[model samples]
Target chain A: MPALRKGRCLSPILLALMLVAGLIALPPGGRLTANEPQARLHNVDIREFAFMPAELTIRLGDAIVWTNRDFAPHTATSAEGDWDTSEIAYGQSSRQTPTQLGVFDYICVFHPTMKARLIVTR
Target chain B: MTPIKTTLLAGFAVFALTLPAFAQAGLDDLEVAHAAYTADVIDIEYAKLALSKTKNPEIKKFAELMIRDHTAVNEGAAALLKKLGVQAKDNDFSKALLKGFEAKKKELSALDGAAFDRAYAANELAYHQTVNKIVGETWIPTVKNGELKAFLSQALVTFKAHENHAGHMVTAAK
Candidate 1:
């Protein structure tokens, strides 16, 4: 059926629609809509000496964590001093409360070559 | 050893010693990547929400790309975590995002058609511009890897494209 095909092919389309609908339906100060898992995330791989995820999205109240897999140290610093990791050491971590909702831009302070986005939904 | 060879040998030894600190700094993001990635997933959700409901066709397409590409990119990030031997737990930031999005959902929904498009476009412009500055100003110079340097060099491409798109929409709206 074309409906099924559309569903399959345009799954991303439907997802886009739902994403917007979800935002439009978001409550003030960001209240979780569904009782879905709290840590719904997209991991960013730092390999080939690059920030793999490049950009990512998370709900308000969610967190964005970074890891250093390569042979060099990297940092996840937010632009405009919004939020940042103070040089997450190799095999170490940093965490933050993205309570404020907005598209936050960040980069690894050490590498300057590693960049990522933390999109906090609200 | 030849004079040039001696110089090269010394450089290699010093380079090896200095490289560890560079790697150590990069690894720090790993500590935050998992949690950060989840929060960012929420951002994509918002961008898509704005796109689908917008009256503007271009905004719609761009939103679609944001959703699809970002999803793939995020997934890749997950695999990267596995490769690097990292495990992530759901943290407070993710909880806050869910709560915030649920709160803002209705207002964003109310802005329909052109109004929705304008808001969405403006938001995109802001987001991409910030991304560009961070990548150019921060990420590009963060690492010691030559390959990464070149790869990061291209990050501005998408941000610039979004800027142009959003700029057009904003200009059209005025």
Candidate 2:
């Protein structure tokens, strides 16, 4: 009887974890916030058909933030990469910390021509 | 479950879990959208890089469109994330994909004139089609949020048109 009860309880817990895991598996960025250590104090502004600072630099532990100030919506995304906030919208911001040190480039999803670069370093 | 319960459950699941909850959370659906979201952004960057090196007018035009459309979607998504309170992501998969795209872009950019145009268009067509399939099969069914569902749906429509146009450009170039 104890064993049966234990099994029942355990399954729901496991089931719950699995569900959480599923959502976590979604791409980065769509679920990002303005505050994340990955891109510490990094700012991205969307205006005039371009993302300002087409080139930005931040600490490895820091983040790069994008705020869509343009009349049109714009996303700051990595072409072949993933991000905490793969995209950002007007009057909104997203952040992420680059785990590694290198130059990362991203573009606005709506307007691919609007590209920007993030240089993450120690 | 009753509609009210279902809606409640779905809402709770989003706060407690993630996208396209297959059984309850539809994690796969969210992943598909996330993946496409990631891929779209990556493509946008690639398009920019391609435009800089390529001389073709049509290709340049397409790159510009990617910037505009992707920005809207990303921003819309960011707004939702804010409401959800879930943290933004910078996972290994996204990092690696960007690296690969950069390498490929470098290789493709090495070509010039018509060859460059042909390669760029070919890549765009392939990328868009794959994204369409992933979103259609994995994302649409999994997503439970009413607003997010609608957003993805509209994005897909725009994406399909973009793919069609890219295909036309590639074929015309050839």
Candidate 3:
């Protein structure tokens, strides 16, 4: 009975080990597993009439959230008219996910001097 | 500071020193709020006049931004005052700002076409420079209320941005 109990205890341990090993052994660039890095959310800040990073890079599926730390309202509007996070007021935030993979230049419509760029990669 | 900023500061200091209204020791919290709110209203008025008179796209865009931003700032000031359960008291500084606005209105009303746009751009630049100087150098230091001080600090950043934008517009309009 002691040996039987030992076997039962080792079963889950071995299974967990196998699962981890399987995840590790999965082919690169094949398919995303439970342990693979997934889409991420990045943050940008607007303060003193400028974007904190002024430029960013992310994966295709990643998202960016812009928070206004200035008293004035602002927007992240794409130069090509592709996307716009419009009228983000003080203490407010807006989010965007780029569907296309490339470089995009954007500016605050209210204050055109405020400029930034985003790089999206697959 | 940049040369332009230094010039703006020196010019604003002279303008402020000339105004007997702001030379007082300091303004109370309500008085500060009143002056800030009045400034917002005056900018909105100027923007409206710009919209009515100018056909230039750049000037029109700048005017629209002034109206939207100043209106928003005034609304925020009004909400904060309501929350504190007090009304902003009209002081000499506020009165002086209104008087100055009336004088500028008459001056701007006399111009037309590109001349009007150029004058409007220059006025916006000077107005922002003066307001930013006062808000940064005066009210932020003297206001006793923590919330009001914080509000002014944030508003100063926006006004400073406006000063820079106006500088660019002044060049473009010319």
Candidate 4:
């Protein structure tokens, strides 16, 4: 009878332990941990009238943040009028996350000579 | 009206009408060069003050750019003047602009921190706007020399960009 009671006690404890393990295995936000890739952030600095990395390559869904370190205002204006960062003042930043796969050429509307290329790939 | 008084009034009216014309006679190549040089110098002077007085990184960067770009412009103007065998001549407009800049510098020096940044940025915006207008509307049309006109035209493009940058600075300071 004592052994039977001990088994009865062990059953709930085992169930609780199994429940906790299941909870731990589940991903945060209850989302599926399957084939979804994570997005990433990349930084591009503007200084001395030019982008630090004048050309950048990134995968789709990745974001690029452009920070203006120069005293003058700058704009990341797309050549095809697809995207623009308006006027990024000194020490200010703007972000662009390209969804399409293509090469986007941009220039500072204020400083036409300032140019950069962003390539997005699958 | 009495005859002498009428004559005097007519003379004054003639002077008034011609006064605008005289002022609108616009700057000669030498005066234009001088004005351009003086303007750059004034910008550099104010920028140096901004650099020393402000702690904001944005304003400091702007001040540095002002110093760099204006210095380059001044050097270019000087070289152009030398190449053309023309001596820069001072004019009433340039003198007044210098005086205004001096007063602005004094006012800006009295402030600190964000106040200084705001005032400096606003002043830069106003200054560039005025310069852009003068270069585009007055100087470009009235400049008699071919090279000088082209120079003013080119400088107008730069001034327009500066004006836009200054406008951004003004908003950022606010």
What is the DockQ for all candidates, taken in turn? 0.02, 0.10, 0.44, 0.03
Across B53-162, the per-residue lDDT of candidate 1 in tens digits comes to: 86666676666656653554455556555765666545443454355445445545767777666655655554455445544655566644453444345334434544
Write model 3 residue lDDT over B1-174, tens digit each, in one string: 445435444654455555544725467899889989998999999999999999999999989999888877777788899999999999888988887788778778988998788778988998887788788877888889998998888888778878888999999976
Model 1 lDDT vs. the true structure? 0.54
- For residues A48-84, write the lDDT of model 3, one tens digit per residue: 8899799999988788999988767899999998899
Query: Residues A1-122, candidate 4, lDDT per residue (tens digit)?
Result: 00111122236676567556663222334432322344568999987678879999988878899998654567899989888988887568999888689999989865766889999987
Instruction: Identify the leading candidate in terms of DockQ.
Output: 3
TM-score of model 3 vs. true structure: 0.82
Which prediction has more favorable lDDT, 1 or 3? 3
**Please, what's the RMSD in Å of model 3?**
8.6
**Residue B152's lDDT in candidate 4:** 69
What's the ranking of the predictions by TM-score, best on top? 3, 4, 2, 1
User: Judged by lDDT, which candidate is best?
Assistant: 3
**B42, model 4: CA deviation in Å?**
0.5
- In order, what lDDT does every prediction score? 0.54, 0.62, 0.81, 0.73
lDDT of 2 by residue, B1-174 (tens): 445334433443342232223213334434444655686787788778777877787788887777776766676666766676654455444454455566556657677887777777776776677666656766676677766676677667667767877888888877
True contacts kept of 4: 0.00
